[model samples]
Target: MSKNYHFIAIGGAVMHNLALALLSKGYQVSGSDDEIYEPSRSRLKAAGILPEEKGWFPDKIHQGLDGIILGMHARIDNPELIRAKALNIPIFSFPAFIYEQSKEKKRVVISGSHGKTTITSMVLHVLKSCGLDFDYLVGAQIEGFDLMVRLSDAPIIIIEGDEYLTSPLDRRPKFFHYHHHILLMSGIAWDHFNVFPTFENYVDQFSQLAAMTPEKGAFIFYEDDPNVKKIAAEVPNTVRKTPYREHPAVIKAGQTYLLTKKGELPISVFGQHNLQNLQGAWEICQNLGITADQFYESIASFKGAAKRQQILAKSDDSILFRDFAHAPSKLKATVEAVKVQYPDRKLIAVQELHTYSSLNKDFVHNYAHTFDAADVAIIYLNPKAVSLKKLELMDESTLRSGFKRNDLILFTETKKLKSYLENQIYQNCNLLLMSSGNYDDMDLTTLQKTINKQHS
Candidate 1:
């Protein structure tokens, strides 16, 4: 095992998880980051491996280091990275190393523009429930899993296969490196426009990944998504292709259960997209020799991954849920899920335009008609954030013009959005705040508490 490795931009969730996994395996790990956030910050501290509070240090890149793992957040011109290069030390992008390390394990690569995190979590949940020990690298914190990333001498390694560029130096998508014995292409939607630039180009990445799987490998696909179905249909006869649909769901007295072929199985996760995620997980687990009974038993205790349809606060009548939904498809699915779960309750779906793609002036039109399912839809944008991302400014009017809902409310200031939420009548209403950001530094917990207080 390689020892004395250093991680560049180690404060990120994935970066820190890799650091901790290395630490657990008795490797001397050091890291640097320009900034850090909670959970990642505290977890690093707990591991007794917190990096120096400041930015990278070139002096830290000595010749004794075994290797350098570059995170996606770090630029190529990073000082320590340049210094490491000068010394001719080996460097591995996060995904490149993950692929190298898990080459022997039967890799199950879960890919999609959205719901990859949830699907990975769902499979891990079922695996754990069945007492099957497997290594995984998931995007979010599952309820029972102490760490989001795990590496071990297990026979299987399940990974959330992101379609984004691997690293600054490696342009191949992360999913490409995974030598998948079982490949699940959830669907392809246009995302990471800063990289792929066109819809067909984005779809091509998945097509390539599908082609990589061996003849004995199974390719699980979404039966409903046209892009996924089309791509899966194009694959050769050697790879076994399995298509999945949303698990049949019924909401009875505020509970969602899967109407499986075996029986009615209950789960802590709800919503139609999650139901689809469960279906995909079930098929993959089944292919791994897990029976339907074992899959349902594991799913019963799965409380969901962090920030993906996470219920932050709840009172008697109204609950506040926050999600990592910035894509048009995700936003639509999340809003529809909340509506279906509580048919009689009003829904306030608030979203922040924080991602580079979401903040793009030309791409805002893709969000048209997405939030029509919500009773009240709000989009919050900050010019400062736009400046930070260096994206073109899209004013409230230009954004509103593109949205099909004429009555859709828009806010440019965090304070105004906070105030509107504070003053609103939330009775018999469930508030769903969706974003890839903090909504311009506003406290989501404060909003959750404020809304719950009124209902209580």
Candidate 2:
């Protein structure tokens, strides 16, 4: 059955991918976004579904459409939405629509504040490595996979479940919509302060996700996280409960090797968080009928997802890494990982406070002591970004008080930050740039080239 689907705000990373996926399935796909950005715009253009013009038209929302998939960027009072409501046209949030499509297939959802993308990518990598045919919806771009979302006749679907709100209209957390046949939670940490006001409120969302899992389903979680442990305890006995911790590994000479019963298995990824993610992925694979040996073999080749502790540049004396670590828990883990991996090298950690939660005055205190592992800590925030987000301006004193680090260097200008970094003595220092956004659009590759030129 060829269905006519319309997407509102299809410029989003996940939304655009889903639109392409539906088009690939022989469905007629049409979409409109107020403004489309790179990659998404280009991808949509290539697929021939790119809207001729920008803004939405109520005429697009008609009775002939099978369903309208809404993106988070669309507003409640959007003209298209108003028309759809008037016509009583069925509308679905991306997450809700994903559930609708995969209801018949076995859904394996990886959910948590951190490591969901890594774990989901790990599972996809392993499944593909084992020659298994499956559909998947991961957050980040994986190395081997061209598309982030895939839909097919595959009996199993792997999803990277986010706890963030599904859409502007759908206030429920995205993960709550995924009734998992197999659920894996890496850990829980308070984030999205705008949506979830308090730590307790944020934690409750994960608990609700656990409660929604069917009795016949399996709930796998990282036992190391106290919050996860609590969630595990609350699950019904009818649900199979499995717990995992960081995989045992030996770090020798700045290289990490997993110590499996099969002996030392060299993997492309490192850090305790990644090890824990790997363990969670291993458990998920085991439940999916993949043997331990097979899991180990496939995981060894896993290079990790993009921007999750990705190596930007490396030299004998100094190495540079860029990671998407906006949250406090993620910041602590990422910095600790780099310091632990290269114990001999001094670590200079630079993080950008770009996200809404990170920029919020009330939420800033959660980041206290997160940069203790770094020899030198620097934080950057663009005042323009704060103004655009309509957030109160955060001065250096407020940031200093928040992190409680007297020696912390703060920057409001990208040029100053870049100049400071370039002038730094990088003899034996590892530079780690952590941010969900690029540091005010600074060209990291250009900076890396300059740094290499200086040292060479």
Candidate 3:
């Protein structure tokens, strides 16, 4: 008999993907969410699993259900959760359930503050090119993957492991539940202000994860990061510790080519951070029994994960790119990447302060000098976002002072930002947008088109 599973708060990105994965695996799947948004809503509907009603229906939850999967969006008092508890149905957090499903396979968990999605995507790209069958769960949408999560009878599963709190009911970090057989640590920087509160508290989570690596497992880390090196060194002798740095690459005429024993391998992605991510992915692939020659040849065609240094539009002289870079370290690296990639072009870098940490007064100071590489630096924050986050509306002077840049341009209004961007002459320039949000739902495609047209 097919096992039946119910997902509470199914409109979430990973939640919907998991539901679809389970459904594809011949399991009976049902889900409910109080609110469903675009992409997720459309996907669930197409899969024939969109709940008849928006809110919870306790009648949907019965004793026949084999298990319940909870998302981070649900509250402790969620009615379906209450019903599930009453019926003694096994409730699994997202990460926990992922571990449960992949128990029979070797789990490779990519854990870090940033670059997790990119590394995971790179691994998947090479594995697919080599015709290796593997399941994966990545945070962002890769170019060829239809869904973010895939579960199958494959021999191994790659997961982009997040350190955020799991479900509302589970206080532990999500990575704790993964119990990875192989772990890849990308450089860590402090994030998630509300949950972590302090840098020490944040680092502790990674330390605990490192300590959890089993005797037979491997821990791959970035040697360039002092924190990563320190953590890796602490791991017992029983576990394998492998450290990697950025791959050797050279840029010629705005294109980057990896220097390999086989020869110069042309790739679509650029940036030092990306090179480092590639190296980490290469290490993981090598450990999985793939040769360097095959990995390099296959990875040459990888463009990049969506929004992680994704190119938006380009003209002969002016190019536009967008990245999901919010943290201070990522901001600095991204800005520098653009400057180095196109040294002749003037760089106009714009970023939106959307996350709770970015909006917090205490955290703003951490962004100092992050945009120094950009010829023109601009910061945008939706006033409504500040108010919604229950944060004080930070004035221009405050941000300027925090960034330690007197000439920084600040915009609270999306209209003004758009107008400013549209009016600018982008000749011999590159525009880079960095944010976790969509710039207050602005039409980025139209904006990029206008900029490119203006440039032409």
TM-score of each model, in listed order: 0.96, 0.97, 0.98
Evaluated at residue 131, the lDDT of candidate 2 is 98
Query: Candidate 2 regions off by >4 Å?
Result: 451-456
Question: Which pairs of residues clash in candidate 1, taking residues 3 or more apart in a chain or in different chains?
Answer: none
Q: Write the per-residue lDDT of candidate 3 for residues 411-439, one digit (tens) a residue.
A: 98888898898777888888999998889
Provide the lDDT at 266 for model 3: 86
Query: Per-residue lDDT of 375-454 in model 2, one digit per residue for the tens?
Result: 99999999988988899978878888999888888999999998888777777888999999888778676658754654
In candidate 1, what are the lDDT values of residues 1-456, reduced to their tens digit? 557999999999899999999899788999999999987899999999898676999988999998999999999899999999999999999888888888888989899988899999989988887888799999888788888788888999999998888888898898888878998977677888888888889889888988898997899999899988888888888989899999888888677977877777677778889988888988889988899778777788888888888888888778889899989889988999889888888999998888898999888788888898899889888889899998888766777777777778889888889889977777788999898888766866676777668747
- Model 1 accuracy (lDDT, Cα): 0.87
lDDT of model 2, residue 245: 94
What's the residue-level lDDT of 392 in candidate 1?
A: 82
Looking at model 2, which ten-residue stretch has the lowest summed lDDT?
Answer: 446-455
Per-residue lDDT for 448 in model 2?
Answer: 81
What residue pairs are clashing in model 3? none
Task: Return whichever of 1 and 2 wins on lDDT.
Answer: 2
lDDT by candidate, in order shown: 0.87, 0.91, 0.91
